[model samples]
Target: MPKRIPLQRRGRAKPKFRPRTHKSLGKIELPKQENTGIILDLLHDNIKSAPIMKVRFGKDVMLLAATNGSRVGENIMIHKLADLPEGSLVCNVESRPGAGPKLIRSAGGAGRIVGKEGKLTSVLLPSKEIKKIHSECRAIVGRVAGAGMTEKPMLKAGAGFYAMKAKGIIWPRVRATKKNAVDHPFGGGGKTLGKKKTVSRHASPGRKVGSISARRTGKRRGKK
Candidate 1:
């Protein structure tokens, strides 16, 4: 028998909201892209937004953006004594001379060299995880441009449709419970099965969905 793929069993893993008593606020806007007034060859037309400054390691390879005052053609190195460059979009900081960068690879992301202990350099990730890496590795400078891209709002359904279309995701998704039993696993909820929200890891395709292969369910109790 072939292995069964686990299915998710829930509407969504989102929090429920209570209606606001005060006047409802308008919709939220997306963020704005930071334009550094400079452009590079490969990064010009590919991504959602451009970086603040194009950071490069050597002749060929390119790195993330450098925000603040770290300009387009400045060089900074990682070491034990001095601090890292003040404002740069740094990512994949190497561990040692030969070790490649392995951390902080996102927009508006940068690593702080917390301290050094022997051969290991403690780097604070964007997620607050402190990683110990080699001290000789280098980190680019700058917070990526366009960190505030989510501040802007579409304010229209058509805008959202185009956005989803650009990402190649299917819009207007209908729920399984809303479907007939013949169509989906959670179908026929009125008669088939609405109470059972969890299924085994190896459930057949027709009976999947819910908390498939769930180790545990129900309310979590707090320690008194």
Candidate 2:
């Protein structure tokens, strides 16, 4: 009998394939109302690379993604994007008016305010995509902290594995060719994939490993 494919095993959501959510400190979100808060503490979460700031607003407390130059005891203002001036750098931006922070939460990431038009504001994202978001949507000022985290090398396989483990990612990825014929579609073909690697966009998960719905394959030939 053939062993269960990696796709099937992962889809089963077993402990080995599940994200280690127990390690997460808490969800980071903007408060419902605009309020000034003082940072009570800076914390590290096992699942997040960015430092989290615990802030207290009056009697209520909330967690936010720490920004560069942020410090405990510092008073931070939570305001709508429309209230902030143009050319300001921001992070943890809400995609909609009441949506809590759906973008720019990655460590060292920030979105620049290009300009505002009517009820929408344009932001230049870290990926260089210009997205128009609702002006009333809120965000934290400044770039996300933990910059240069990637610049530091792991220097060891164990260190890399532990890092990926914290993020609930499977490390030491196995190539399809290294798998048995029953495991992957491109398996048991030595170095060469016996069949065309490109797959249909509607291919099932078990057979969707390679370049899906590729427009064209092979190296481009210049005008000869």
Off by over 4 Å in 2: 198-224
Report the Cα lDDT for candidate 2. 0.88
Which residue pairs in model 2 clash with each other? Answer: none
State each model's CA lDDT, in order. 0.49, 0.88
Task: Say what the RMSD of model 1 is.
Answer: 12.0
TM-score: model 2 vs. ground truth: 0.87
Model 1, range 142-205, lDDT digits (tens) per residue? 4544556566797998876655544444455667677765667666657556667888888776
Q: Per-residue error at 100 for model 2, in Å?
A: 1.4
Could you tell me the lDDT of residue 163 within candidate 2?
82
Which 10-residue span in candidate 1 carries the lowest summed lDDT? Answer: 27-36
TM-score, every prediction: 0.58, 0.87
Note each model's CA RMSD in angstroms.
Answer: 12.0, 3.1
